[model samples]
Target: MSAHGETPHGAQGGHGNLNQLMAGFALAALLTIVPFALVMGEVEINRTALIATIMGLGGLQILVHLIWFLHVNRSAEEGWTLAATIFAVLILVIVLAGSLWVMKNMNENMMPMHDMEHHMQMEQMKSLQSQQG
Candidate 1:
């Protein structure tokens, strides 16, 4: 036991592991800046590709943060954490994909097939002629 009356291996009294964790978090934060700039900047990224890349990278960042900051690893509740992570990811993918599919179908089915402005103008003209006559 150290002067602080705690186990040396535990995180409470040890600065080394804490410092390493802090550094990892800082690096992860720094890494995210590039993605932020890419998203915010005027560069024309292909919409579908960009969406896919962003999703993939965002998932990767989440995993990194889980490992570095949350300490979800082989040594830390290994099987349960892994199972939970997989289940969460599976649910997210299912929901997102299902919503996208439904939205695409709805857009295709409900969108106007003709020029809306032209249709509205013709209806207005007919109404005016009926009123005048």
Candidate 2:
């Protein structure tokens, strides 16, 4: 009712908002920079470990953005936003898994490098013999 005509539900003592935002920003930056450093080999982690760590950090950053910037919480919209987020995550997982499955199948069915080179050489020989004849 403070001149804005809308009720503020969870207004903490005035200074908390700025502090929360700064903390979220710092965490997001740390999440981002650490992953990049791991990727660049500055942390000396195995490729598998690095990938896992990066993905974990990415999930944390997503949560930070959702909770802090987007302000999506249990109280927001009677929890419809959280439901939608879960659905979206489900869809993303299905699509990514299907894509990886298809790519792996395609790779398994593809000709090996030696076979491709041999095929190319055979085609070239055929072309040269046809030209000579």
Candidate 3:
């Protein structure tokens, strides 16, 4: 027996990282294919439902990448990896939401061309009246 009460690099044991990786890849591929087919094929899914399904699949794909590609498990580094990942995701969401909100507000509050033109015309009328007085 070796450290952690497991044989050293033994087959058919110790979480089967390769098998898990293959499963994760297969799941990710399936998620990708489903959405692609929904978009490209003749399926008549509702637009809102389709979008929601796509987003859900994308989130699952992210989880698969995290667990399989990055090897972020519960025991790894005392779960610091998971914690860091959550923190990073939180930061990303905050930044993206804040940016979008600012852009939307800017677009909503901006003066239109007609409003500017009206203001300019009013100013011209006031200048002419002052000059005439």
TM-scores, one per candidate: 0.66, 0.65, 0.57
Q: How close is candidate 3 to the true structure, as a TM-score?
A: 0.57
Q: Which stretches of candidate 1 lie over 4 Å from their true place?
A: 1-16, 75-77, 102-115, 127-133
Model 2 Cα displacement at 90 (Å)?
2.3
Provide the lowest-lDDT 10-residue window in model 1: 9-18
Give per-residue CA lDDT, model 3, range 1-133, as digits (tens): 7766667644433445777878988998998999999999958989768867877787788788887677666764448888998888788668766876798799899998999999999999999999999
Candidates by TM-score, descending order: 1, 2, 3
Better of 2 and 3 by lDDT: 3
How well is each residue in 1-133 modelled by candidate 1, as lDDT tens digits? Answer: 8797777656532434767788777868766876687789846979777767767777777777767776665555367987797788889889878987898799878748576777898999999999999
- Root-mean-square deviation (CA) per prediction: 4.7, 4.7, 5.8
Task: Order the numbered candidates by lDDT, best leading.
Answer: 3, 2, 1
Higher-scoring candidate on lDDT, 1 or 3: 3
* Reference-based lDDT, residue 131, model 1: 100
